[model samples]
Target: MVNWQFWKRRTPARILRLRPRGELSDAVRVEFPELAPDVRTYLGQAAYLQLGYFETLTRLIRATPDLAEKEALSLAAGAALRKHLALLAEIREEDADPAELMEPFREPLDAFRRATVGARPRETMLTVHITAGLLDDFYLALASGYGERGRRVARILRADNDRRQLAELLTETIRGDEEWRALLSLWARRLVGDTLLVARGALLLDGDGRGEAARAVEPVFTALMAAHARRMDALGLAS
Candidate 1:
């Protein structure tokens, strides 16, 4: 078995590095417990991630020879860029430099991209599909932490990502060959560990919280897995 706990091999890193620049509000404290990152942490990580997705899909476009595949990837890339810009706008409204806010996360998030990106184009395509879906939902779930600002972030995350085309590309390829099916299924299984680790790392957990409080993460974890299974099923790949 490929150890899904692969993030263990890397130096430990924190994804949410800042205290809340403003109120995270009391609502999330009551609702999500210790899981809410501050508004800036939320904004910076969310924006940078979409930018990373845009860049990855754009690179895939250059490497892909087929015009139709290139076009499909372009739509997904463009969608990610739109979300990135929208997040930058939100950062500016808060009177923070978008570049500065995003700077701290550059190393860790880029490392995440390197870890999740694949050796083959098909595998890379699947990487974007699975990771984006999981993280998008994860962030969306966490959005309510910042009150109204969080709501706006939620709206941006909810926008059409045009990732379905990426899915179509993967599904067509997987159906044609058992080898691709097996390879992608295995790759996807490996990805879930790293992807979930990124989500878990971003959360604000107590220093020694345990038992039921630690297990509070279980529901969010389960929700992420359910959504992941649905995506794998869409590609006819085992979760």
Candidate 2:
């Protein structure tokens, strides 16, 4: 059997070596043709996990009033994202059984994972606020560092009035634009590259100045949130 630990150690390097620049979809297809389709689908969703894309998707999701519709969007987006992560895990385990590697980092990763479980639902609320034209710095603070913590902060910020405002935004006018979509898509691709890099070891999450990898990602998420805000304002969705 291929040394599973070697595979785990090598996976990040392999992912990083596959792409130095250019389109991620192209890179992924070239690296693993069998997973190309799934890679494309995951990237689209991962793009949401990207800076502007996630917030935009969240806004779109919040804009819907039907509970079923909202739930479906969350499942669709979240599931795509989850599938991408699963692939990463599979790649990490390709050489050997993953069970062996799970013992070491499982706890911290799991803790962090649970911290972010609220993202899909809370994302609806956060996007709703941005759409309503209210920019809460505290909300930004929570979302700034590792996003899971940010979601926690956003929950605390969601007072009764905040919830009402978000509901109003959802019920208000909406105009879709191609430009915004294109910009968000571009941003998402870059974000995915950065995230993949971190996962595969192109960058360390705890190196010098990297305090926690999640903190490193804060700015990316923040910029994306700002971009979504700008897009909403540009489109006149927000006053």
Residue-pair clashes per candidate:
0, 3
Q: Give the per-residue lDDT of model 2 (tens digit) for 1-239.
A: 11112112222211111211111122221121110112222222222222232334455577778785566455434533443344344434345333443444344333322332224443334332332222222222222232343344334323222233333333332335555444433433333332323232212233342455445444434443454445445434442
Which parts of model 2 are misplaced by more than 4 Å? 1-66, 81-93, 99-105, 114-120, 123-202, 205-207, 210-239
lDDT of 1 by residue, 1-239 (tens): 22222222233222211112111212222234555556776788899999999999999999999999999999999999999999999999999999998987788888889988999999999999999988887887777556778779888988899987789989999999999999999999998888887887776444543556447766666666776787788789989
Best by lDDT: 1
lDDT of each: 0.78, 0.33
Q: Clashing pairs in model 2? A: 12-200, 51-224, 142-150
Task: Report model 2's TM-score to 2 decimal places.
Answer: 0.29
- Candidate 1 Cα deviation (angstroms), residue 108: 0.4
Q: Model 1 reaches what TM-score against the true structure?
A: 0.86
Question: Where is model 1 poorest over a 10-residue stretch in terms of lDDT?
Answer: 16-25
